[model samples]
Target: MHELIVSPYMGRFVMVKPGRKEGGTMPAYLYRELAETAPTSPCPDWLVKAARQAWHTELEGRPLAPAVLVRDDPGLGYGRASWELNLGCNYDCEHCYLGIKDFAGLELPERVRVLHTLRDAGVLWLQLTGGEPMVDRLFTETYAAAYDLGMMLTVLSNGSRLFLPKVLDLLTERRPDRVTLSVYGATEESYDGLTRRKGAYRLFKKGLDAGHEAGLPLSLSMIVTRHNAHEVPMMRHIAERIGAPMEEYTNMVPTIYGGDETLPTQSAEHLRRRKPFTGCNAGHTFFHVNPFGRASICKVGRDPAVDLLAEGVEGLSRLGAIADSLLLRQGGCTGCGLQGTCGTCMPLVQLYRKAEAPLATYCQHREKEESV
Candidate 1:
């Protein structure tokens, strides 16, 4: 049985395995030193209480509960979890990440079990995403379950189904921690053109209007592509008019299966000029569980994953090893000159590469950056 040590305020959790033997009766001064070395954050009251409990128990010539002591330790650093509920979508966007595959995801009961496992594993924030999470039949069931377990839930949707009475009612009743709407284009011609669907812009607005009427806090995101990049300003204005903040993302990588080439990527200089966010926060503090109950550090990390339904908590130990193996020091990416500017890392290289070395697409970016 694994134990979860939770800091309620900071929403950080450490998972402890059986017979770890890291914590026991120790000097008070040593414990203080260990606490000081832990991640720099405002220590929560739950941590303070756990520490006091540990000290009192230790004074009595016994070891404190592992959960109490694990607070000051950094063995486990899981905080946020993302679920790709299903890979089915109504509107077919050209630059879809999962491509146009229609995958039959985990059934309701299995999804419920996975959610329980995640909560028990000390996940604090749960983000439900997908081709459009709201479009899934089990969306409400899973959302309700997460809400019942007190997990902070966020829903990512295209805003097409939001105008439905049932959809509006469910959101009104549960009121997720946050709701994000992906706006393809500001106008119908551009939006429908990108989505390749007629009457999409009207439906999207209907969803946004419904979200606002339900009093749900909505955030807007636009996938910046050559097809719709010019509409960014107009999209921002629409977001502002609707009283929701907007963000633009231009980093369009290849699909998981490497099929879609419809959306053109940003220039190497443009990608390099932005802040360096090379390694993803996969198994470290973030996780992505696809609809098939396959869990990985991030969405694009499909090749290396653990089937949560088959293994349960015992399988999560792989995540820590995954995090370690993905470190920059563990691979050739360590001394590379294009460290910050280049986005290719071991995990991504593993995802897109066809041979032992990185693909030309990644090297091209690095080469371009070098020449400049």
Candidate 2:
């Protein structure tokens, strides 16, 4: 194995080895530096802004509920909840809509206020996701505060920045119960091919190793795409190597970039190989906050005219009525072979101008997989 040099810290960037490529063992000095300071550059600036928002709410004394999961009975544990904490990221990997160029940062406090509102409304399971949440400096204090509030905090990340010894220490100190890392590729070429970089595969792997060494509860998250879908085995290999849980989902939304082409395309074989899914429980369960603060029904819904934050949750529920319009209910859902047993693909409706069609590949490929 070739010796990999530790790369200097870029903005929230943790594993860009400098002197050598990352095919072999990591440099000893790099490990020492990581042990010293948690990577702080990748942290987003909006975290502070979110705190300010919480302060404003405190001053106003107006209590707002967050994504509340109303339980008729009980038995529910840490009901599902997630927040798209920001729109910034450290890489421009294919299959990511944010790979588009015009992405900007979200105001920090506004997000914090939203969290406060949601937590107050009974949200317990919290997921902070973005280009990458670990890079945001605000995560330092936010994780601490959330844990103090008795909220189970989780960070959805790319595993690029977590390699720094310091970053790993901070995560351990905060002790976030869960960190979901998206493993793009197992090898450097496959990972670089998707991320459009030459060495992202190594950086991601190194960071993940650091996170695991820190004794954090880590899970591997994957988006099944044609470009990297074939690498599913690779992702699984990673999960096995690290003892992390592995999960993969069909394309949630289509390519929605305004200008640049060069988007990812999944192969029929890959789409077929993907776990069969039917519809999405998005609006009925989860939702998204756009860069401008509009709370849309799904990640691809960027309708600024219907801003959920501005209108509030009530407004959000009302606006998503657009989702149920006569036109959306199309596609033969009745008597479908995979109806009750499969997950929803509802996000595709808004992402594509056309009505949601049956994922032919999904239906055909998994027609014979024995029920688990």
**Model 1 TM-score?**
0.74
- Candidate 2 per-residue C-alpha lDDT over 1-372 given as tens digits, one digit per residue, 9 for 90 to 100: 101112212112122111112212224453343345333322123322332343221212221112111111112111335666556677787667655534454455665555554444334456777767666656565555554443556788888888776667766665665788987776777788877877778888888888887778898887666677667776788789878888876454445543223223554554434344544454444455554555555555444324535554445445435544422434554455655444444344334434233444224425445443
**Candidate 2 residue spans exceeding 4 A from truth:** 1-79, 99-103, 223-231, 250-253, 256-264, 273-281, 301-347, 354-372
Question: Candidate 1: where are CA atoms >4 Å away?
Answer: 1-76, 260-274, 277-280, 327-335, 352-372
Strongest candidate by lDDT: 1
Q: Count the backbone clashes (under 3 Å) in each candidate.
A: 1, 32
lDDT of each: 0.67, 0.53
Worst 10 residues of 2 by lDDT: 64-73
Tens-digit lDDT string for candidate 1 (148-240)? 665667889999998888878876776666788998888899899888899989999999988887788788987776677777779888888
